[model samples]
Target: MASLLDEILFETAGQGPPPSKDFYQFFITKNEVIWRWWKISGRTEFRGTPPEEIKMFHHNFLDDSRFQEQLAVVFGNKILEYTLGLCRRHFDYLERLPDQLLLKILSYMSIQDVGRLSQTSSRFKKICNSEEIWKLTVLGHCDMITEDMEMLAKAMGWKNIFFKFYYKNEHVNMASPAEEEDKANTASP
Candidate 1:
């Protein structure tokens, strides 16, 4: 089972182009066990809409519970509430949390949520660009920092912070054995 899943991931990762929204949608359902475990462990909540209706773009809808929680924080209750209301019928068991709680919820969302919520409104744009928020949300994660992420982080005034984290990783790899041997031999014997 693990090998089968690995083969699927390898195939997906090797796609000739960046995945389309539809591809991401299929990506979510491909790991049903993980989704189920997440639900049971309180990491996620499932909605009962027709599976056929689940398109990749629908990922932009109120799909990820963690993402919804973060959007509520970064965009404020008014917009968040309205957004929630939009998808409420489809996702009936969703939780309604207060804004105070919502702020902390930002930490729980995936970086994808940060990017998506940024497109929602100017208010969200502001919060998403907040240095403290980005720091808490994305730093220390494996090279998730990309050029676009840097642009977003810069808007939040954390470009240097992002670069520092990024280059540090590069430095570690560049300092590996072969480079170290050259550096050692080049120095005074």
Candidate 2:
């Protein structure tokens, strides 16, 4: 399996009523979690008053309460909570798959299954509802498709085209109303 890595930078106010801004960088990889913090100081005399602190630990350390307490002490409760949520989000394997591969996999699924999967996440919804996927579905299941039909698909969208052809058992005329009017005018002349 491929390893995943994610990094996030955020500002937090630490124990100050006026909200002193500090930068926190949280890096989570397959095997470790690293966090670095830097306090922003605006005083001219204390230009480098506070320095950056970096800490790294094995993934297993997250299970220890001592580690959590240490992180809370250093990053404040809100930052720690936000960082933990990022860590959890990084492990979503299906969401990390490439769109092309996901579309290929979805092509194999039944339309009903794809519809249900679309409701699961925004990414899935976009992929499941995309024209490319619907086009592929139409091409795979339909016996005959023509250039004219493809032009119609482009105008009406692949999903609409697919349902119209697949369920209604009718051919869609690709000519626009302007083209039909022109044909009528030429025939009258």
For all predicted structures, in order, the TM-scores are 0.27, 0.59
| Candidate lDDT (C-alpha), each | 0.46, 0.70
Question: Which numbered prediction scores highest in TM-score against the true structure?
Answer: 2
Per-residue alpha-carbon lDDT of candidate 2 for residues 1-189, written as tens digits (9 for 90 to 100): 244333323334333223656555555554456655566668677567665554554455456667667667756787577556654553456777789989999989988799999999898999999998998888887776789978999799999987876734532545658999999999995
The candidate that achieves the highest lDDT relative to the unseen native structure: 2
Candidate 1's TM-score reads 0.27
Show where candidate 2 strays beyond 4 Å.
3-20, 41-53, 64-91, 167-189
lDDT of each residue in 37-150, candidate 1, tens digit only: 111122234433223322222335556777556444443466456554533432321123333344467668755686687787666666667776656555655546678777
The stretch of ten residues in a row with the least summed lDDT in candidate 2 is 8-17
